[model samples]
Target: MNALVWYVIMKWMPKGSSCVDFVTQRSLYEVRKRPSKSYSWVAFMLANICAELPWNTLMSVFIFFGWYYPIGLYHNAEPTGAVTERGALLFLLIWSFVMFTSTFTHMIIASVDVAENGGNIATLQFSLTILFCGVLVSPSKLPGFWIFMYRVSPFTYLVDAMLSVSLANALAFCSSVEVSVFDPPSGQTCGQYLSACTSIAGGSLSDVNATSQCEFCAIMDTNAFLSQVNSYYDHRWRNFGLMWAYVAFNVCAALFPYWFGRVPKSAKKN
Candidate 1:
């Protein structure tokens, strides 16, 4: 659901299209006017980066409020009593996500003359990121040759950090349908029969003394489930940091294309 939201919003991010138009028309006009001859291309690029910050930050706040509490993800934070910490982390992550999206869109569009061309390229890349970000498919299950996509996709870190902080340490109570029922050995109680397995595998048994009915939940905790998907609570913060790294990469990447492709030949010679 989050990925879908990201895709929809980012696909039409206005910064890229607006920047394309500004560079082609307004900025060029500025460069042509005699009085604006001293205009700085660097300032134009920096302005774009800074100007999007407040809007994206506000957008992220609204998204966090709408998406976080209504889904009852707050309850997941209760197990460890880190509600405030977890909530703040999630908000920051969402903010970073918005910032990254804007910058990434600019990065893709900066070198293109037409907005539609840039949109097509952005769509293709975003599709690949969503596909390999470990949401649709587990990282462990990815083909060996394509595994690099999972590593390179910024969505991988965002999803990992979000899911790890949101779901880690929460306990799972298996419903009747979710539980596996079996009989203990004739000579032993259910607790005794399954103690070794539970100790190693980590699950709670409903009845210890029951001779015939042994109920088991294979997923003992949220952390255990996360492990199956190759995400860990210990790495959530690291992933958060990596996401900002990608944002930085996007900003730098956008600047490079604009400098090379959009800057005047006279400016380049200088």
Candidate 2:
């Protein structure tokens, strides 16, 4: 639930407000005029990108405090005595997420002739990321052909890292209703019957000596649950690094369309 909330918030946060409003508005007048007069498109793009950095950084700090503690994800690190380490990691990931959102919004908006068109494209792209980011649907459950989408989505790494940091190593105790009850074979104890399966799949067996009413908690720990969704605790930092690669990609990509298509050829000749 925390991961889902994070994903939804990050994905929709830029949608509710314009991240590149400053840049896009400049595109309407200042970007074209400056490029034609003395500035190169690259210069304009660089300035615009740099100009937004401080604000985005500030926003990330606000978002981290507002969302992280309220969601109670800090508890995940509490039991493991990794509160400081995990907290710092989560803050960095949230900061990266904010930077990605801003840069991605800038890229899409700059890549088009019309802001409306860019917005529509961005919406479509965001929707695809949401569908394939291993939240609404597990990557394991996605069909072979659509699996690439899961791999390509930036949200994939972001979500995986966030979930691992927030949920990994924690124990999951099933409520009475969540525990499964079944009978073991005629001569076997519950542990003897299900030991092989639990050894491989992970679960806790109750009443090891009983043949009837064998209880099991299918989700033993956060690690086991994360594995089922194709995420792992060990890969948390790796995924965080990967997510920044996407952010850098977005930052670079934001310059392309505006430079090639939006910039006037006459401006280049100047």
Candidate 3:
């Protein structure tokens, strides 16, 4: 599909120019021109951050109050309640950073694809994104080489951070019930100790005993549950820091392509 689109675009492109040349020239022109001194790149970045802040905060509040609050109440869980405020703040920060990084990273990728592959790299890019982002398999289960991809993907950090913020301290109560045979001690007084008590009094053990009580027990605690699923909060802050670092790295990466692609063909020959 991408090939067909590129073919059509190339076939009809302006007589003397290809898509790559056009994109490179346009991008270089934009970079070279001083649009406004008051509106610098730093100012643009700040504006993007500020613009995303309120939306991120609103989403965090909704998740905490609407989703977390009700679920905690339903389960009679109190651990999350204590840290809801802190967790929400962390969630907001991480989400905002991720949004910023993803936006510029995507821009960088698209720009590079246009300049190098005539934008035919979409399918490859999408596949790689999904593969490395833990969408197809969990990071812990990925093979050695693929594990590197998982580790490098920003999606992995986002997922880990979100899970840590939402479910780290949350408690889940799980119960199991079982029926067991009533066996008396070897020397105990059988008549004095009517050990078997059932709904049908004086009924035989083999008979239907609807009155027999089922034993219900708690299976595991919060830590056990988290460990079972390989979820942890110990590295949440670290992940957040890494995500922001990715944002910075992506911004630089996006700009690098523009610089690289802007070199004139004649200059390269000379």
Summarize candidate 1's per-residue lDDT along 48-90 as a digit string, tens digits.
Answer: 6788789888888888898789878889999789999999998
Best by lDDT: 1
Off by over 4 Å in 3: 1-77, 105-110, 113-130, 133-136, 175-219, 263-270
Roughly what TM-score does model 1 have, to 2 decimal places?
Answer: 0.88
Candidate 2's TM-score reads 0.84
Estimate the Cα RMSD of every predicted model relative to the unseen true structure: 3.0, 3.2, 12.1
Clashing pairs in 3: 199-211
- TM-score for each of the candidates: 0.88, 0.84, 0.54
lDDT of 1: 0.79
How would you encode candidate 2's per-residue C-alpha lDDT over 70-135 as one tens digit per residue? 878888888889988998898898888877777777778775656566677777887787778888
Candidate 2: which stretches are off by over 4 Å? 6-13, 16-24, 27-38, 184-189, 209-212, 266-270
The global Cα lDDT (0 to 1) of model 2 is 0.78
In candidate 3, what are the lDDT values of residues 1-270, reduced to their tens digit? 123222322332222123354455445444763243444444443443356447655654654465445544323224545465554545454454435433443344434535445334533443465467554577677888777787677656655655555555554444332223344445543332343543223222232322333222222235444454444677677777777777677666655564466433344664
**lDDT for residue 129 in candidate 3, whole number 0-100:** 51
Question: Candidate 1, 261: how far from true, in Å?
Answer: 1.7
